[model samples]
Target: MNGLPMVVSEPGLPAKVTIHEVGPRDGLQNESGIVAAADKAEFVRRLADAGLTTIEVTSFVPPAWVPQLADAEEVFAAVRDDPAVSPALNLPVLVPNMRGLDRALGLGAQQVAVFASATETFAQRNLNRSLDAALEMFEPVVRHASEDGAWTRGYLSMCFGDPWEGPVDPAKVVDVGVRLLETGCWQLSLGDTIGVATPGQVGALIGAFERAGVGVDKLAVHFHDTYGQALANTLAALRLGVTTVDASAGGLGGCPYAKSATGNLATEDLVWMLTGLGIDTGVDLGRLVATSTWMADRLGRPSPSRTVRALAGASAGEKQ
Candidate 1:
């Protein structure tokens, strides 16, 4: 498979893409059942073994806000102590505000992510603050995280369309993204929170960011597969030289703020496409499938990832 002919869809597709695995944090936060800290630790270890270098391990938000991740400290400690997990693995935890940052810092977190919204309505609903106020809230978090020498990521949600606002302008999205970058965020992840973006909208948004002097190197994409356009939109971003892509294992997350939003792009599905394109991700598709399948059993449901389903089905057939 390594010797396969390199296939470039466009003139300058990225030689490799970075997959930011967000399953343990973004994926599990939306889950109805609270996963045990030990289980979450095992999940992260499995992802690390599967070659997911950067995994969002957990969120430092208050338990009242996200009970599923209430055991953030325990989960982080467990994974940190596991000798089997690579020491080089980047485990980023979500830190919503100063309090969250304090908690993550106490845990000796090496990386953290702050989330904001592209539209005013979503901002008010998710963060309970206005657009400007939400950005202000993250300013200190990003600054302190940077000062502490921790890698910081800024997430801008509802970049394409908001449920209340309908269609979003690409210029507005770029402006919000630039603000996040200016706030000391090392990287900005533009999110299709409601999964409303198409390839054309994605291309336009990335192009606008580039025109605004925000290089693709400082940008990543987080697409939800609500409309089955996550992979398609990702392809568009990759063609534009956006290398970092955020996905969940087993397609296991949704936006609690945006009710219509569904699961994220599955890591297995993304890996299949990247491998087919001869793009290096350093991920093992079979191990990823096994991890997701194990997680799905814990959730008491089948994985939403088509790649996982196909692979699992083939494995079952072989035994039969």
Candidate 2:
């Protein structure tokens, strides 16, 4: 389906937006039931078939830490050799540190991501290091990934508000973001890990980054849907000319570290809004909803995405 016309009243929005699909990795990582490597491979394949060019396939963190992605290498191998997979598809794996980066590189991963937190409590609890120390750990990882001819992405978690720390200062978020960029990260994804951000907070964060001399092009927004405001926050980002967005299929994942944090914004839901806004994403909404429905069945639950649920219900009614 084509995007709607841009003659409407939207302002400062990009003509096209890049939806970075993170279901296979971020979405599944929080699941209690472990999905087999082959199923994970099929999941990635299906997402690509649905025209998601950028999918985060897996993470190379230690198996003990995240057993859900224990078979990262196996999962990577399955997709990397698939003839049906697009050669130009970007399958970025999360590399927590040097060890994870080495594992990803060993598997011949072309892209990797490193994550840091804007809040000290989360940094200490999640990474087991102070914020500065965590960034220090990622610096070498990002540098080595770049040197290895692989693109690197940095994830700055708790950008808007942290569960432990009530409200986060946008300037501090920008400071952490700039450090990641200076460390050779090609792109930085600002994450609202606890999902407490409103549209005003989103705009303030983006504005701070822009004022700090960081281009919006180097930034992506990753919002959790816990507060039911992911779509609103995303629209705020889009209105400010930030094009890249990180989302999961079926709204599958949440921050395991943050007890209150919920699923990432669903890709299907995001696409529905973007298409209606006349923003080109090149994703087939029907196919995306179908893919999410299939995944929801695998997980033995209804999808968390409003668009997916509505579309599936309509399809069921039509069949009836």
Which portions of model 2 miss their true places by more than 4 Å? 1-9
Model 2 lDDT at residue 138? 89
Per-residue alpha-carbon lDDT of candidate 1 for residues 216-247, written as tens digits (9 for 90 to 100): 99999999999999999999999999999999
TM-score of each: 0.97, 0.97
Model 1 stretches astray by more than 4 angstroms: 1-11
Candidate 1 lDDT for residue 220: 96
Collision pairs in model 1? none
The residue pairs in collision within model 2 are none
Q: What is the Cα-based lDDT of residue 30 in candidate 2?
A: 92
